[model samples]
Target: MTRRTVRIAMNGVTGRMGYRQHLVRSLLAIREEGGLELEDGTILWPEPVLVGRRAPALRAIAERHGLEHWTTDLDAALADPSVEIYFDAQVTAARAAALRRAVAAGKHLYCEKPTAASLQAALEIARLAQDAGVRTGVVQDKIFLPGLRKLKRLVDGGFFGRILSVRGEFGYWVFEGDWQSAQRPSWNYRAEDGGGITMDMFPHWEYVLHELFGRITTVQALTATHLPQRWDEYGKPYAATADDAVYGVFQLDGGVVAQINSSWAVRVHRDELVEFQVDGEHGSAVAGLRDCRVQHRATTPKPVWNPDLPSTEPFRQQWQEVPGNGEFDNAFKAQWELFLRHVVLDEPWRWDLLAGARGVQLAELGLRSSAEGRRLDVPELTL
Candidate 1:
């Protein structure tokens, strides 16, 4: 039997996510896991070639990973017959054009989210990939997250019987890019660069809501630029043209109301600060990045609310910590492995370009809802 190895060309290898998430964690780390086994017991390994604009950065990354193939020319990598898959981790503004080129070159695509800056662009890319008959996927990493997966399990197990509503609190104060040294790239604060909390986070919530709950049918949103100006990495001030905080209400199928607050201004105050509180008819569940807790009627005990009472005994016993069994891989890396299997072994990967398009649709609708101060019905896209 021939040992099948999928050769992947990674675009934007120098970027933060490209380096840490995709390159190191996903490709190198997963490769070091003795490769991934397919359902048929066949093993698949990824051979990644780092592609970026900077030679020094690319070389440094390649050397750090003990990889020999590194190049600054995208066309050269794309033209290589050995490169069967093209992965894009470029900026949102640059993703469409690059992916289009890759698709035209007949390489399968696995790209970062928002697939494109706008819904139209996303749709076009999806159409292009479909027309070419090439395998394609998007990064819907949150769906693979351990906490979110556990939440899905509870939802599947009917733990939250007839979920009534979902409340998501996601975000932490991003460094002001000044004396604090920004946690994110400077472009993320600018609208022209397709950087904003809404654009960055809505796709994640969309997948989470749709996968764990149901599809969103309508959205009413209000966005704010709380910090009009922010400092860059060098302490240089730049106008924040995009929203730093976004509040949106999504009405899912079956009348499930999901209210999401995604912000860059809030401080991290609790464990698994990014939480999803789901209330149901018989029970409620709260899931975070690290833990999940539930409160069912069977386990709930009647308690009196008192301001001066010591809060040690009543409800504390009711709350149970979900176990962390060390089976959870980084979200991005898990998605990467799934995509690789999908491309090589024909496994079903839900985060396709169409799913990505739907996310962009929701973001666009949210922005329109904010601008018009009216609820917008989300249109379904043909996959």
Candidate 2:
């Protein structure tokens, strides 16, 4: 059996998502498990060279993860023929420029979503990658989640006959840092830093909606900077120039209406940080991060609406829990493995740069819809 090693230039390892999801959970975990095994008994090992601006931070991450390579010089890393893939998880505004460099240098591309800050930039990146003949992908990690997978199974099994609507509740309170420290990075609140809840979350919504229901045909969005002032990491206050919350309604190709609420200002009163409820003619289901509950029309309870009497029905107990059919891995890691195969085995990669541009298009158009205070039709994005 032949063994091959793919060296990836992993830029932005110090950031939260890059560190935890990409590096620790996906890359290092794959290496620890003896690499990705192929069907014909070959093993493909992934060797990531940590690339960052800070030498100490890079060195520390490499050492902690028992990795062999760490480099602060991105130019040097890109110039090296040994590095076959270039990944970016930097600030949104900086992504397209870095990606241009990567594609120009003739490296396979994969990175976080909202590939660029704007649709124009995102489409340009896609075009450049196509002209360069490089394999490219953007993270669409939400669909790989267990709960959503279960929801998809129900859809495939015809459990939901003619789906009607989907309601999603996402987000929890992020402290202002006066007393409790904010869970998110301070840059997340600054518009100049390419920060906004709509920009951050719409990509997730785009992929989830397209994959499960259908393509989004139109959108109506209302965004808000709920708390205009918040404390930074240093406990110093700053005016938030970007939205912390968004309320959106999307029209899907299959006539599915999806309404989602994303907010950092609101408190969580649900089962998880994110949850989606789907209603159809035959049944209904609600899915959280790890669990899903379903109630069919046959078993669904009916309650009379009475203003004068207190309701005593066990509403929650009426739904049955969906069984976990099999082992589920980390959502990010699952996509990482598939991407590795797409790069190495010449497999069909559907979630290409074009798909990424579509996500960027949604965010851009969604913002425009909110500003215009009207429903905007979403034109199909093409390369």
Candidate 3:
């Protein structure tokens, strides 16, 4: 049987996340890894047309993937009847416009997180897609992490009975682009470009928090721009308008409190760059990207503190390392596979634009809370 190809028009294909995460990974998965399979003994291979501003970059990407199609024309790509899906990895500010165009073209939509710069815009995009009856999905990749998956299992299995609270530490010092090149784009340091710790990471925490504990009801946040100026790749200084760090406390439904520390200025001294410590009545679990450790009531230590004594063991060593179960794909790649399956096999994909809206809503609330020096209530979406 012949395979059904899902011809994809990829916008922002030459951008950082676009080139490294989406385009390259999707091409390899569909063409090499047998990632997408259809029901009728057919495979769902992606026929991707690279789209971007720079012709040279697009051509280079196309050549790297052995793809023949490359274009700088958005309207031309959208006009092509062969394209069934429109994928956007553009900046947060550009996603809504790109998606609006894609929906008008009658194509299924898939894209990165914080689908739009504002909550209203994100909601509008979702409503428009729903009205048009086109399938839409947003990247909620962190939920696919093996560590987070294991944490979810523990929650589901009632290991963390009567869940109490969650603490998340996520950050790594992003180079200022002086000594070493900036790991992230310069737009990430500008507010007008929809760059900030809250906008970038709150959505990730939203899904993880909702999935692991419960929905976030309220937020009290304090945001900071620790470094007001940063140097670019060439040691050219640029003013930083976005907050580099954010300290937020979320009030989840059912009295579950979650504190999240998100930053671009912190050094990674732990097992993994990101870590979540969940405490409950029955047990406590500390999960990192590489490992997850739990201490139940039965195995937890009972000790009293002494002022004049030095300990031989580090507190971190008290918990044992959890073994890796098997091979795990990159978080973004895993979600790409799931999204492709949804498009091809009619599988249920939960990470839609509505979910994306929730993320934007939280970021807005965090900013508001920080600005006003007060707690803000997060309203539920009508959609």
RMSD to the true structure for each prediction, in A, is 1.9, 0.8, 1.5
- The TM-score measured for candidate 2 stands at 0.99
TM-score of each: 0.95, 0.99, 0.96
Error of 3 at 194 (Å): 2.0
TM-score winner among the candidates? Answer: 2
CA lDDT scores, all candidates in order: 0.87, 0.92, 0.87
lDDT of 3 by residue, 151-197 (tens): 88889989978999999999999988877888888889999778998
2 against 3, candidate with superior lDDT: 2
Task: Name the regions of candidate 2 deviating beyond 4 angstroms.
Answer: none
Error of 2 at 180 (Å): 1.6
Error of 3 at 333 (Å): 2.2
Q: Can you tell me which runs of candidate 1 are displaced by over 4 Å?
A: 39-41, 303-317, 324-326
